[model samples]
Target: MISTWRRRVAARRAAKKKSIEEDDNANMELTIPNHFRCPISLDLMKDPVTLSTGITYDRESIEKWIEAGNVTCPITKKILRSIEPIPNHAIRQIIQDWCVENRSYGVERIPTPRVPISSHEVKEVLTKIEDAIRRNDDESCLDFVSMIKSLSKESDRNKRCVVSNGAGRVLSAAFDALSKRDPIHEHVALHEEILSMLMISLSSPLDEETRTNLSTSESLHYIVRFLRFGSLSSRRNAVLALKVILSCNDQEVVEDLVKREGLLDALMKLIEEPICPTTTKASLLAMYYILKSSQSNPDKQATISKFLEMGLVQNLLEILVDSERSVCEKALGVLDGICSHREGRNKVSENVLTVPLMVKKMLRVSDLATELSVSILWKLGKDEENGEGTVAIEALQVGAFQKLLLLLQVGCSGTTKEKVTDLLKILNVHRQSVECIDSLDFKNLKRPF
Candidate 1:
C-alpha cells in the first residue's frame, strides 16, 4: 500500500501534475506530516536513515541518490567521504507515535523495522558462540540467543554470515546438548531458546558439521521431543529443521527419521494444530517429505494406516480451505502422496470439502500448486463412473469442467492436458449436457498464476 502511494507521488513529480496547494489538499486523504517526508522523495520516510552529514532521509531514496553519483548531502550540499546510512530510530519512533495517535483517522502505524547487525557485531557474536560451544556453556548460549535470533531476522547478508561463521555449528551443538536428557521445569525456558535459535540459524540448511549432527539417530530422537512437549516457537523451528534435513535426500536418513517413535504422530499433530501460517507450512512440508519417503519403503501400507489413524485427510482438507499458495501446494502434494492407499482414498472420499477446494485451486494458485491439485483430482476421479465417482460429481458441481478446459487452453503440458480431458469426459458423460459447472470464460485465464 505504501508502494502504491509512493508510485503516485513519483508519477506526479515526473509529470509535474500538481501544484503545492493541490498536493496539500491531497494530503488530507493520506497526509504524511511535512516533518515525516524524506527530503529526496518528498514522501514519508518508511525507513528513516541518516548519513554522516547529520541529515536524515529514507534509506531507499538516499541509496539511489548515492548510486546515481551524488557525492554530498541532499539537504546541506556538504561533501561526504562515505555513504554510510545509519538508521534514525529516534525519528522513526516519532513517526510511529504520530500514526498511533491518529489511528482513528485511517492512519497505519508503520511496523518496527528490523535493524541489521553490523558485520563487526556479527563476527563478535560468532566468536562468542563458538567459544561457548567448545565449553558447552548453556548460560552463554542463552545470553547470545536473543541477539542471534534478532540478527537472523535481518537481511540475507546476516543470515549467510551466521551460517558460514560457525553460529550454525554452535547452535546445532547446543541443540544436541539440550536434547541429551529430560528437561527440568526450571530449564525448560532455556531449552526452548536453544531449539528455537537453532531452528532459525539452521533455517536454511545445516553446514557440514551441523548436517552430520542431524544425521545421527540419537540427535533426531531429541529433535522429535521438541514437537511433543516444546513451546510453540520451538516446535515451529523443529519442523523448519526437519524440512531441511529431509531435503538433503539421504534415503537411508529419511527412512530413519520417518521411523523415529512419536515423530510421525507429533508431525501429524502439528498438521492438526491451528498455529501460525509459517509453522503450518513447515509442518506441511515435513509431512510431504515423510509421506514421499514412506511411499518408497516396503512398509508403505503401515505408514498410510498411520496417516489415516491420525485423521490427516480431514485435517489437510480443512487446512486447504484457507492457506497461502505455497501452503496450498504442499497440502495438495501430501494429499496426492497419501491418496494411493485405500484407507487414505476412503478418508478423502468421506470429506465434503476436499473436491470443491481442489476445483477452486485449479489455475487459482501457482502452476505448481495447480499441478498438485490436479494430481489429487486424478487420484480421486479415475475409473469411478459409478455412484462412487463422487470426485467427478463434485468436480462438475464445483466448476472443475471449465477450470480444466481453461487449464488446457492455457499452456498445460501434454500429460496435464490428458488428465483434464479424461476427467472432463467422465463428468460430461455423467451430466448428459445438463452439468452445473460454474460459468467461466476460457479467454479470461490469467498468465503465471
Candidate 2:
C-alpha cells in the first residue's frame, strides 16, 4: 500500500512540476534610465514632445492625458493655454546617441518619430491614386503605391485616414490588375508594394463600401491566388484581407470561393504549418467565417465536406491543443461551426480527444475561449445519438461534467449560462450509466432556462 501511495504521490508531484514549467517563462528585467522615461508611463519615451506648460512627455501619453479632459499639466498642475505638442528633438537625439553608444549592452535605438498625416493630404493622395488606377497607368500606380505605403508608415492616424478615405479599394484594384498580368511584364517589386498597401489598409477598421469592393469576385480570385503562389508578404496580407472580407457579409463571393478548387486546402495547410502567428490567426478566422456561412446555404454541404476532406478537424484540434488563447478561441469557433452539421457532429462525437481537449480548454484559457468551447460541447451534446447514450454522456464520462459545473459555479456570460444549463440536462439524462457523475451534484446545477 505504501509503495502504491508513494508512486501516486511521485507521479502527481512530477505532473504538477511539469505544468508549472510549461506555464512559467524565463524572467526578463529591463531598465530605462530615469531621464529617458516618460513621466506618464515611467517607460522610455519614443516620441517626446513639449507641452505648453513647459514639460516634456511622450506624445501618445500626453495626448491621451489631455484628451481625458485634464486641464492642467500632470507635472506642474498648471493650466495650459494650448495643447499642441511641440516635438522635443533635443531629447530624442540624446536618447538615440546614448542608445548607439550602449549598443553592445543590449540597448536598441528608438525609431524615427512619426508625424500624423492630415485628412486633407490623404484626400489629395487618394484622388491621384484613383485616377492612376482608373487609367491603368502602371508607372503611376507604382509611384502612388510607394507614396501611400510611406504615409501609412508615418502613423496609425494616417493609416486610418488611408482606409476611411477608400485606400483599401484603390490598393486592391491595383493589386488585381497587376496580379492578372504576365509575370515577365510586371515590375515584381511594384506588384508587391500594392499587395502590401492593401494589407495595411485592411489592417485598420474598414467601412462597408471598402469591404464590398474587395469582396468582388475578381478581387477575391487574386487574393486567393496570392495564398497559393505569392510571396510570404503576399500570403500573410492575403490571409488578413480574406479574413476581413469574409466578415463583410458577401455570401455570393464566399460561395464562389467555396466552389473554387484548392482554396480551402491552401488555407488549412497554412494553419497546419503557419508562416507566423498572425498568418495562422487570420487563416483560422477565414475558415471560421466560411464554415459559418455554409450553415444557412443548405446547398453548401460540399463546403463543409471539403473542409473535412482537407483534414480541417484534425488541424483545428491540433491548434486547440498547443496554441495560445487567441488561436484556441478561433479553432473552437471553427469547431463550433463544424458541429452545426450532421457529418461534423459525427466527426466531433467519434473523436476521443475532441471532448477532453475542449473540456480542458473551457476554464483553462480566457473567458472567451471558455464560451466558445462550452458552446462546441453544447452543440455536440444536444445532438441525438444512440450508443453509450448521448454525446453529453460521453462528455460527462470524459470529466466535462466537472468543468461545466465549475463554469456555472463561477460566473460566465448569460449565453454560456443557457448553454451550460441545457448541457446539464443532456448529461443528467444519462448520468445513471456514466460512473463518474453524481446524481445529487447533477440536480444542484442551476438550470434557470
Candidate 3:
C-alpha cells in the first residue's frame, strides 16, 4: 500500500511539471523597441527572420510580419515595422486646405465651368422667380420656364457655349445653392415656394433639349423630390427624365438611382404606385440597368432583395404571361437575369409567400407565366443532399412536383426540358414525391421533359 501510494504521488508531480512546461512554452515573450529599424532589410522588424539555428524565422513568418507589422527579433529589443499613420486632426486640416484651394469667388469647387449666365445673372433668375412666385403669377413662371428651356437648348455655336449652355449643370447649381441656403425653421416656407414653381412649369410638356437637361442633371435628389409632385403631367415628365438619364448610361446617374441608399427606396415606391404602368415599366428597366451596371456592389444586394420582396417577381410574372408575346418574352428574360445569382435564388426560396401568390396569378394569366412559374417553383424546391426531410417532404406535397411535370409536358423545350426532367427523376426517388410526377408515364419518360 505504501509503495502504490508513493508511485501515484510521483505520477501526479510529473503531470504537473509537464503542464507547467507547456504553459511556459505557450507564454514565451519577446522584447521589441518602439522604433528600431532592421539591420538586414532596413524595414521595421516585421516577423524577424533568424536562420534555422540562428533564431531567424522561416519565410512564412517573414511574410506574416510584413503583412501584420509584427516582425520582431526574439533576442533583440527592436521594432522592425514601418507604417505611416494619419492623425485625425491632420486629416481634417488636409481636407480644409483642399477645400480652400479649390474654391473660387466664394463658390465651392464644383469642377464644372461657369454657365453663360454669370454670378450676377443667377441672382437675376432668382429675383424673377421670387417675384413671380410671390405674386402667384403661374403664367410668368411658365414663361420663365420656357426661356430657361430655350437657353438651355441653344446649339453650341462656339467653343465657350459647350459647357455653359448645358441646362442640367445650371439647374443643379441653382438647386444646390437653394437647398443649402435656408435655415431649418424656414425649410417649410422654401419648400412650398419651390414646389409651387416646380409644379407650375418644370412638369409641363418639355422639348427634347429641356427633357435632356432635366434628366442629365447631377442633382438626382432634387430630381426625385420634384418628381413626387402632386400633378400627373409632372409625374409623367419625371418618368421621361429617367428615360433620358438612363440612356446616357452614366455610371454616376445609375449609382444615384439604384446603389445609393435613399434613392432606391424612392424609386421603388414610384414603381409600386398603381397610377401609371408606363412609369412602373420604366422604373423596372432602370433597375435592370442598375443590376447589370458596374455600380452594383454588395450593399445594393439588399435593395434588390427588397425589390423582389415588394412583389417584383410577381409583377413580372404577370407580364410574362401577357397576351403580347414580346412582353412575355422580355419579362422572362428579366426574371432569368435576376435569378442567375445564388443569393437571388436563396431570397426567392425564403419568400414562402411568393410561391402561392405567384401560383394564383399564373392560373389566370398567360401560358408563359404559368411555364415560368413552374420553373421557378422547381428551382425553389430543390434541396441539397442533406436538405431537411420535413421541408423537402412539405415542398413535394405542396403541388410543386405536379407543376414541374406539367411544365415538362407542355412548356419547356429541348435542353431546358431535359434539365427539368432529370431534376424530377431525382426528386421522384421518394414515394410521396413520386406521386407528384404521376403525369409522367414512368416507362415513357426516359427522354428529357
TM-score of each: 0.68, 0.72, 0.41
Prediction 2 TM-score vs. true: 0.72
TM-score leader? 2
Ranking by TM-score: 2, 1, 3
The parts of candidate 3 lying over 4 Å away from their true place are 1-219, 228-233, 247-252, 259-261, 271-273, 292-299, 305-344, 357-364, 367-375, 382-386, 389-419, 430-449
- Clashing residue pairs for model 2: none
Indicate the worst ten consecutive residues by lDDT in candidate 3.
82-91
Candidate 3 per-residue lDDT over residues 1-449, each given as its tens digit: 99999999999999999999878755665332323234444433322334322334323334344445454543464654422111223323343454456343232422222223333443466456556645655456446645544443442221122233333343333344444433523333333333333322343344455444444434354456545543554455455455556656666667666644555565556655634666665555556666656324555566567666666666665554442544444455446456655566665556555455334333334555555554554555454424643334544555545655656565555755765675566556654533432233233333343
Which candidate order results from sorting by lDDT in descending order?
2, 1, 3
Candidate 1 residue spans exceeding 4 A from truth:
1-120, 150-161, 177-190, 203-205, 383-390, 428-434, 440-449
lDDT of 1 by residue, 1-449 (tens): 99999999999896675566567665677567888999989987888989999889988799779768899998999998667689999999999999898785667898887765565677788677667756767588578877787777677646755765677777676666655645434445656776677765675545678887776775687667777777777788777778888877778888787677888788887877746878788788887877787776767677778888888888888878888877888888889888766667778877888888888878877888788788778877773655556678777777787788778777777777787777777787767544576655333556655
User: Which RMSD values do the candidates have, in order?
Assistant: 11.8, 14.8, 26.0
**Would you list the clashing residue pairs of candidate 1?**
366-449
For candidate 1, the lDDT comes to 0.76
lDDT of each: 0.76, 0.78, 0.48
